[model samples]
Target chain A: EDQVTQSPEALRLQEGESSSLNCSYTVSGLRGLFWYRQDPGKGPEFLFTLYSAGEEKEKERLKATLTKKESFLHITAPKPEDSATYLCAAAGASNDYKLSFGAGTTVTVRA
Target chain B: GAGVSQSPSNKVTEKGKDVELRCDPISGHTALYWYRQSLGQGLEFLIYFQGNSAPDKSGLPSDRFSAERTGGSVSTLTIQRTQQEDSAVYLCAGRGGQGRSGANVLTFGAGSRLTVL
Candidate 1:
């Protein structure tokens, strides 16, 4: 079974502080790795998709990178609005569009 | 719509009752997915639809759960004799018709919060 595990279940940071969340996974043949941001009572919003090691994508203050065994989401100079649950999911080559997600890291940025 | 849309944003029901949740994918998206979120947990895949054809449904929890899509468009998930364990947020997502490297990309709705009494 494909599995994903995220570390630092929760994190608190002051405004403009920077931190990185981890997403480790084990899959037969990773087809894609995805990052999503979800707010309380709202569904997840797509962020980035990493398909290979050494690949990276960034949006505003968020940057996502992938390696063979894990992926990292780095937030730089975060603001209170950036506070949300960050989810990591992996889709294996064996399954088409089926995603296995990690428990997620809840990030809270204080202003 | 601009994004995936789900109906009945909130539903409170008694155990043993049946409920139906609906999803309207983005206009041109050919793939749709249903997921369950319990409290603060991660998303649990419930099912997926590829152009109105559900090639996989093993993620569904039990026989009491069934879903269908028509005309290659909207879809619905029906739960029979609901239980308290069924209380959670039901989220629906959709992806573009073509794009394997990015096939896993999903756009989600706000989700429907279900509460079983």
Candidate 2:
């Protein structure tokens, strides 16, 4: 089965602090790796897509990097608004390109 | 609409009662998907529709769950004889009709929170 696992189920960061969240996946013929941000009571919002190893995408203070076996989302000088659950997903040909999302990493940034 | 829109933002019901959740995807999006999010579990895929055709529904957990799309725009998910375990946030997403690459470009709604009593 295709699987996406995230580390540090929850993280607490002070204002202006920086950190990174890990998402490891095991999918056959991986097609794309995606990042999403979800706030409480809201659905997920797309962040980036990494189609190949060594690929990276950035938005504001968030940067997403991909490797063959894993992906990383780095938050730089995070603000309270940047605090949300970060989700990672993997889509592969074997899985019909359906996204399999990770449990997610909840970051709490206090200002 | 501006983005995917789901109706009945919150629904509270008793066990065994049936419920229907609705989703109006972004205008012109031909790909639609439904997912379930439990308290501690990851997003669970339920179904996908590509221009009114369900190419895959293997993600649906049980027979009690069924969904349909019309005019390639609005969709509905109906749960028959609901159970306590069915309580979760049902999310709806949609994207362009493009091929494989477009499959990952999904736009989501706020989701409907279902609570079973």
Candidate 3:
């Protein structure tokens, strides 16, 4: 069974603090790993798609790195605006195009 | 709209009543998807439609849940005998072909919040 798990269900970070959220998965044939940020009352916004191990992507103060077993979303000097729920999902190579997602990690960057 | 659009941003209903949610995918997008998100939870795949292909309804939780896509453009999700457990945000997404290798990203709508009392 394919499953995605995100750890540290909730995190409270002081403004400008650096932290990393974890996403571990078990899939039949890895196709893609996705990261999304969701704010209250809205759908998730795309962040990054990591296709292979040892790959990394960055945007402003956010960086995402992937490995064979898991992926990490690293927030550098996160501001209060960065506070949101981060989601992780995995898509297998079955052509279904369905993504299995984790429960998400809620981060609160207090100012 | 340039982005995916969903109707009735908020719906409050009594248990056992049926509810329908609509989604209008971005124009020219061949792939459409529906998902459910509970409070503080990740997305739960509900159904998918790609071009003229048959929709994959494997993720639907029960037989009372059904969806239809008309002309491969707009889609509707219907839930019968809604229960409190069905309260959640329903999200719709559209995916366009980015390249020949099937590299595409899903653009999501703001979502419709369903509250079953």
Native A-B interface contacts kept, per candidate? 0.76, 0.65, 0.67
Q: What is the TM-score of each candidate against the true structure?
A: 0.97, 0.96, 0.95
lDDT by residue (tens digit), candidate 3, B6-67: 98899999999999999998899988999999976778888888874645878899999999
Local distance difference test, per candidate? 0.92, 0.92, 0.89
TM value for model 1? 0.97
Model 1 lDDT tens row, A1-111: 999999889999999999999999999889999999998878898899898999999999999999999999999999999999999999988884789989999999999
Q: Give the total clashing residue pairs for model 2.
A: 0
> lDDT of candidate 1 vs native?
0.92
In the range A1-111, model 2's lDDT, one tens digit per residue, is 899999989999999999999999998888889999999989999999888899999999999999999999999999999989999999887765489999999999998
Chain A, candidate 3, TM-score of: 0.97
User: Which window of 10 residues has the lowest lDDT sum in candidate 3 chain A?
Assistant: A90-99
State the iRMSD of every prediction, in order shown.
1.6, 1.7, 1.9
* Candidate 2 wrongly placed segments (more than 4 Å): B99-103
Could you tell me the interface RMSD of model 1?
Answer: 1.6
- Candidate 3: pairs in clash: none
lDDT (C-alpha) at residue A30 in model 3: 79
